[model samples]
Target: MTQEKYYFENPKSSIRSLTEDEIEAAIADYENGVKISEICQKYPKLKVSSFYKQLPYKLNQEKCEYCNNQIYTKVRKNGYGNDLAKLCIYCNHDYTKNCNCEQCFHNTNVALEEKRKELQIVWKNFYTEYYNLNYTLNDISIFDEIYLVLLIQSYKGTFENTLDFSYFKQLRFQVHASSHEYYSVINNLIDRKILIPNIYYFDSYDYIYSSEPSLPTINSTKINWIPNIIKTSGTLLSVSELDKILKERTYSVEDKKILWREVYWSEIKSYIDYQINI
Candidate 1:
């Protein structure tokens, strides 16, 4: 058995487990008079998988040496003599580790699954926005998605409109991660054209606003690619019109970079027209 603790802190149940002898006794009681629910309530540490190991009707089946759970085999041995019942999913060896944590139902595997589901909702909205703009995201891992969410939240909506490379290093990484992670994502963003490092830093003030040798008077918004312009219309668009329509939608350097766009020539034309009108 693996002796290392499976929990970060004290687990929900401290007892090791109900012994096989105790389980057999319980099964005997269940057959005589005791209810199955009462037996389960009495031995809360006994998992359903473990309980099934003691069922009398099941024949010729062996208990997993590690966890003592029933190994229900369908197909026989493979070419290498490996059977489907060779290993339990949780404990992958002959001996099982002791993990009576609150979850196995508050365990790491279940917690991560739940967290992944939560993140799906968040990423769904993010991807849905890009889908309108003819962009998409590839298969990203759960851990990366978690880190991305944390990174974006740290920015507090400042990067949503603008992909300012100057400040990517400033935001706090959630789990004490190194600055290299942010820098890596930044470089990728630049490659994706999500972060035009100094899109707003043009020296030609004459081209921006009239009668000022300085930058245009801007608000708290970050300037993003107009969202869903192609999905909304096939006609040519002006930059001024795009700005008006997509003023409310914004993209941070990170958000835009994560999106993978499938470019349409017509959409590109509209975008070029918008830029030309600007």
Candidate 2:
């Protein structure tokens, strides 16, 4: 009599629940290169991430060829699953165990060659413009040329057009220059208005005497040294304008910046090579 009490619930499935047949159809569509969004529309109950998680076991479990780890089964119709599972996220889609077949090697070299030629053209054009801008200043020293190129390269290569002032100290070591010579060269560039601070104009004396103002003397309220982020302010082609001018020749400002970065980085290394032993 106690066991006779029973409850009946509705037979409708939850929003996340999918029948086996629906899952099978979704998997078939995904394997055939259908977009995940399209599949989600076809089966409204599907969650992309959850559905993707289930993909690892959808077909027979297979080991990753590169990492030797168990992952999703392969699909011959399209290698989307294989690419998702095997490609290294950190390496820009390069396989962990890179393929060394002749085709792969040839493809890699051809891509590099094309990139090199493109960068060479960019360098030549920019160098011509840079030279034209500073041609009036005949006193441009070799160190000035090298330092300007390095600064442009760093501004374009780094995440932001900003760096710690101490970075120049590290560059001095890299280029085998003394502290005195390094600061002298920096001052020279600053005097020529090529390198300008990205921060507000401040006098070092304010930080040196940060004490409260007395009857006769006034001092800054701040106590810490202000950090400086240097920017390239070229006489002919400022860092801001360089990318804009180059954008006409490239895909975008970002792509042009990358090409400029590559060219200047190579130029910096070449300068370092010659200056290292001298």
Candidate 3:
């Protein structure tokens, strides 16, 4: 007998992709409690694992609490080196500080202006007492009082507590006043003996008093005899101390007095008392 003829054949199978409709159907069936093995049998071209990978799932993202806009979150550290709160992506707003977005800028400015107004009231009250004690209350003008307060506030503890003449010029721009107004205030303060010429640069008093016939004008002029640096007869409070005083809610007159130079407080109190009695 002839040897039995044997034939072996290998069948080629191509992967058939599932359409969008087929994928949707599979996803629906899978979500409806259909077994993975059954679904794989139904679509044998792709594995159940592949089908599961294409399934939809909920995303882990955060939304802005204010506007419900999508925001990215990041892990930040706090002062103690711990995890901080989530920051808003749009406004840069966080739990720690105010938002920097344009929408929030108006509120921030309003808050700052309110704070400035409050501080102004406090400063006005604080300096009004000082102004009344130093000058005759009846003769005191709010304009002059404000100028005196501004001068004291601008004190920077320069040489022998002297301030540069240029600061007076700059004050005109700061308060939207004319150069004449600022200089006039300075002249008044000088004539009242509040601001004294810094005589430390002079070898003797004769140079200032040398019968040169000084003509006082409120406006800036070309005068060679004008002093560039001026000082107050009494020591002025330092900027840092004034800042501290401004921050504190309750500061006594005694506390304010102590802020001055130790040597001047007694004399200041004595003068204040004398003026009060007068």
Candidate 4:
């Protein structure tokens, strides 16, 4: 009778174990709109909390609703007072705003304005030098031709198809014996600061005309280029000259310098063409 009192051990375990196939099936059922509780019920061994833990990893398999981008499983805060929201890093959007969810627009606008100002300064300096070179070579002789070729090639980093030096020989046949002489002149010009080597290429024919050598004076000095134009024409020469020319037809030292470097070179060509026939 005592021997008949032995009991059988329980086969069911507290810890639930699911195979890879079973897990995939659970995920597929949840994706098909089945509730987590229902999934647990169907699995019998799967706990409710355990199903929620698997939910994130499983739901991340789907794509984002906004940009059709892949959804990321990691949750992040939307902003102040908002709960953690799901977002696609590729096309981030806060669903609450009802806008294309992205980072703050204010920051983006500020960044763009700063970049625009920087680009404007760069272009202004580049154009100023270009105009200076055009004025320096009033008649465009062999020296001017070679200088221009080197200048363009220097700044642009490489020679463009538009630059051709064959015309220099046709002009009065006074061309140098060889092009090497032109290179030597350019090298001397670089050393004298009349030309600045290309900032990009350390060792090459690339060079930019320098404005430093022709800086204008601040006082009402000689009629060096700019004041001459203002005196000849009753009208103001440029925007910088409008105030000075209208008030006294005289420019402060700084303003005169700026006018000479930035505007005089471009306007000088037209002024000279009108004054002289050659």
Model 3 residue 175 CA deviation (Å) reads 24
Compose the digit string of candidate 2's lDDT tens values, residues 139-205.
4433344455445544342323332333544454231233223335444454344443332222233
- Give the TM-score of each candidate: 0.20, 0.24, 0.27, 0.22
Pick the winner on TM-score between candidates 3 and 4.
Answer: 3
For residues 212-278, could you state the per-residue lDDT of candidate 4 as single tens digits? 4333111101111111122233431331342232434344687556655544554565577556756
Per-residue lDDT for 1-97 in model 3, tens only? 2221111111121112556566557656765667877977888775655444344322115666665544433222112333424545446544355
Local distance difference test values of all predictions, in order = 0.38, 0.42, 0.43, 0.39
Candidate 3 has which clashing residue pairs, if any? none
What candidate 3 gets wrong by more than 4 Å, as runs, is 1-62, 77-85, 94-99, 133-278
Pick by TM-score: 2 or 4, better one: 2
Best-first order by TM-score: 3, 2, 4, 1
Number of backbone clashes in candidate 3? 0
**TM-score quality measure for candidate 4:** 0.22
Which pairs of residues collide in candidate 2? none
Cα error of candidate 3 at position 89, Å: 3.2
After superposition of all CA atoms, the RMSD between model 1 and the true structure is 21.4
lDDT of 1 by residue, 1-278 (tens): 43222111113322235454664566566555566567777877644433433342212246655466543332222233333323333443322234443334235566656655554444444434533333222333222334334433444233344223234446552211332222345333323433222233332322223232222322112222221123234632323343343444455766554442322443575578668769
